[model samples]
Target: PRAAAAEHADQLFAGLQDPALYRFIAEAPPTDVEALRARYTRLATRRSPDGRQAWLNWAIWSFAEEAYVGYVQATVEAGEADIAYVVFQDYWGRGYARKAVAEMMGLLREAHGVAGFRATVDTRNHRSRALLEALGFECVAIHADAEVIHGRSPTRPSIG
Candidate 1:
């Protein structure tokens, strides 16, 4: 995984503009390329490991179609990391998010030695909740309207 770069701004902008992709996400999609570029620029600088946190991000790509699809990220603090992923709506249900997230979990475990992962999913996003459950995450808490799921490396029995 590599840091997000400005070169990816165009495809990233296009992917984020899909309303279906952001339906369950808290933040609405940026309305223009300039906004997307600014966001990407901020993400790029987060690659440097500060004492308080480590931010990792990667652009999702489809080799078969030779295009950028989406992104996956993990923000590590203390001994745990919060993970999230997004794929263009057109690529939804194709297992791209699953593959990317699984690989990220492994990378975070092996490379960073993170003890656990946390993911916040919209309560109504059953698909995302199911994916996390399949990965052995258990819903440990709820905040506002979102469910907070937690998982450890090697995985434990899932809880509701």
Candidate 2:
């Protein structure tokens, strides 16, 4: 079962191909069942340390967008204290993304003492940019390939 989940993770992100999304599960080698088991068990049983570091992936509801309809992934990085996410293609143009992002920000602020966060979105990803804006993130910088967005938590964010 653990092997299967690991395989599924690899297969799932392989299809998406965004490095940000893939980074969450890319190191898992499906053929290494023992390693997969260890990793899977840890993720399955671990609790967020009051939100200092958290990773989540959830399915978006059907009937809102594309056939893949609903899926969301988020991570609050430890050092830089950035939050990032990506949604499935079919789920575009829906409000699910904004809602999920806002919620993740809440989790980061309430549970992790996160004061600020950053994100890098592909330059052409207007949908993602809009979602970030709706969540109160500010467009801070534009890289050659990506636009950077930042949000401040209600309280002072942790440096760690």
Candidate 3:
């Protein structure tokens, strides 16, 4: 399969559409599998159009659920990976997202020479902001869009 193949997109599409998940971000979920498949097709390249960034996406497979419960995505550029993740509505409050994000950061550093990290979250999404904070990310900037982007070394977070 591709970096984000249609098959995997098909499987995860429905679960990715829970209304609660869209509250903090723009763009509603795809109305159908075909839309998702087409989108994933573009995401498979692992690179941005300008060739300045690398796109990484991984499905989070849960042993307990015996299924893919979520995904971690990163946009790597200039030695920093702007990361994002989602662990579908039914699977929230579990440690799956935390574990996956941690592992993905580790991989980005060791495999891709990413020395710093960044993440943008809607300010209203306190849980997500806390999750990034818990992972040692510091709030570096808050934008007019009501979003915040974090910047810090992954291993040396000054959580206070």
Candidate 4:
């Protein structure tokens, strides 16, 4: 639950390179470590205030496995944030994504005063859609290719 750093690039790249994990992601995973390192370097810089977007990222580590598993992130703008997450294929179906996202929401709410969140999921990604729904996010709109889901912290009143 810390900010991403350059040292994490190799493990992150290794976990993300599984093609099965990229099915619904916008871009394919980097083909090599150097490409991943470059991407991570840019991500690290975005933590600065001068960066155009407020990007919060965390590398997920499993204590039992003693390894980095994946990541969860939020792109913030104004009162709301867009959230996304990824877990290595080997760790799929273990409830890790759900737990991580729930924890992330708490951190965002407490630290950044973000009361609401939105997530866009490909229509075919049933697992992700279910995860969001389970976390109290409701599908607000459905485009031809994707669905937009919104959630409010249970401790906060809903916003229209």
lDDT scores in order: 0.82, 0.53, 0.80, 0.83
- What TM-score does each of the candidates earn? 0.88, 0.56, 0.89, 0.90
| Residue runs of model 3 more than 4 Å from their true location after superposition | 1-3, 156-160
Candidate 3: tens digits of C-alpha lDDT, residues 1-160: 1145667886799798898888887778888998888877777788889999998888888889988888888899988888888889888888777888888888888889998888888888888887887888777778865665665665643322
What is the descending TM-score order?
A: 4, 3, 1, 2
Every model: Cα RMSD to truth: 3.4, 7.9, 3.1, 3.7
Candidate closest to the true structure, highest TM-score = 4
Residue 17 alpha-carbon offset, candidate 1, angstroms: 0.6
Instruction: Please provide, for model 2 over 67-139, each residue's C-alpha lDDT reduced to its tens digit, 9 standing for 90 to 100.
Output: 3333444455563356555555444455556666666566657766667778777777677776666666788
Error of 4 at 134 (Å): 1.0
> Which portions of model 4 show Cα errors greater than 4 Å?
47-52, 156-160
What range of 10 consecutive residues in model 4 has the weakest lDDT sum? 151-160
- 67-157 in candidate 1: lDDT tens per residue? 8888999998877999999988888788878888888888888888888999999999999998888887899998887989998565433
